[model samples]
Target: MQRFLIALCCLLCSLPAAAWNGAGHRLVAVIAWQQLSAPTRAFVSAALADHPDHSRWVERAGGHGAAAIFAEAATWADSIRNDPRYYDAGRGEPTPPIGGRFDSRRQRHWHYVDLDATGRPVKGELDRQVERLSRLLGTADAPDEITYALPWLAHLVADLHQPLHVGRSDDDGGTRFTVENPFSKRLPFLSLHAYWDELPGPSSLRGRRLQREAARLLSEHRPPAQGDVDLWREESRHLHASAYPHQAGSLLPIVDEAFQRQARATAERRLSEAGYRLGRLLEARLRHRVSRETP
Candidate 1:
């Protein structure tokens, strides 16, 4: 019994750490938080109030507290860095110098494909993760516990919106190719995978201004309809075949242009959709909770 308890303790302790890593995941959280509506924001705020560490940081940061929240989200990504299954194996470890192509087979099977595809989880593992999150949130009655789950859910959903996160199994969704950043000459800081991760918009924007920019883009572009999702899937497949192959060649300018255009469009649509979806979920949940508490 003592041995079992020790093992269980270790496993339990490792679980949170395992979930944390992947900047991609944290980036989703940052985007989701930025895109939240008023009610959704309130729900997130109430949920976060239960978390002393996160709450304390927010409180200390004051009105611009959301910035701190995104910083925390970024930090959380580091915690889950060791979980290999969460990322594409093709990227060959998260560090750098990634080379190779994405597996076509994996792309078909995973719902998390890329800018073109939406909603398919690679190998159906994402559904199980969502189920786990649901269970966790179900048992969590406190605001803090709820807040913890909120970010996780929000972030994961956003990650799914990122076409690269759903990448192919073999090439790990373009994780192998390395490219130089057009904006920076400091180093050859480019990878097919990294390019996808940072796509569509400049990372320089922050706070409400960033949120406003995303909102404006969404207003201008609009979300793809259900029919559009199919088109995206087809386009993603095409991109996988054509773009992934030439990603490493002397086609830097062409590749950069393609990535920028796709990233911008995807970012606007997904960010807008995340806000709408999160608002719907938060409203339903909050209404029920309020009704239950009412005299």
Candidate 2:
């Protein structure tokens, strides 16, 4: 509960309606995982097997098949952030991704790169990690590397596409600003970042049903022109500038139907775009391994 409030504080100043909630992440994951080549799917499954949450994912899978695992994997980074044990005092500040074979803690900063409010891209661990993991996936294909990279890749890709996650030199991605409840009554107000996060979908999308929703979304939207992080960053910048306008002093913005419609459209499209790009990235990197036997 303490961690929840801290995250709530960091996620936004007011009550948290959403900060890229799990249902949205799972929707993005299911859409991407379904498009994977069978070999890529197998590779991803095998990789996720090493995740600390794997057994829990399997148990939660129940009758829904592996879709549950895909969804659960999408939320693992966020789960670890909320987990107190990972934040135990022994772990140093800035929380590095635990190194070596026994490492269990997550690298908190790996999730999002904060671009300056002026929109200059601030280089972050996310960019480096994505590049490194993509290279390893393409050439190295080490089992341990694959196991670690896949989850981070999935989480980070979705994270990059979130508009606020890529913005603001100051503020925890707009966690500093607050707004009236136009999205939902669950919270009386929302932080600017949390508002964008909630734009993707409801807080809990009922597991397997979200997969079906992902499929529907895919049918309606075309795949990305191609996956490019630069393109993703530019896309985020536009969404932030046009749709999420603010005043000089940080007064709260009013959330009305017009704003919600535009944000919702952008978020859904981004979710689909992120998903297709994830599939493309994985397929490009992992397809070479089809002929090699699993280690």
Best-performing candidate as measured by TM-score: 2
lDDT by residue for model 2 (1-295), tens: 6534643554444542223788778888888887788877877788788766678777665556665687777777787776554663456644434433524665666666667757675744555566676777777645777777777788778887888777665765666766655457676455777777777677577556777789889999988797477788778767766556443222346666777777778888888988888888888888777547444
What is the C-alpha lDDT profile of model 1 across 69-180, one tens digit per residue? 6435433333334434235446544333212221111111222442324434344343344445545555667644465565455545444454554555454555544444
TM-score of predicted structure 2: 0.84
Most lDDT-accurate candidate? 2
* Clash count, one per candidate: 20, 0
Off by over 4 Å in 1: 1-40, 56-62, 65-127, 134-145, 180-189, 200-204, 223-248, 251-259, 293-295
Q: Give the poorly placed runs of model 2, Cα more than 4 Å off.
A: 1-19, 88-102, 245-251
TM-score of 1: 0.58
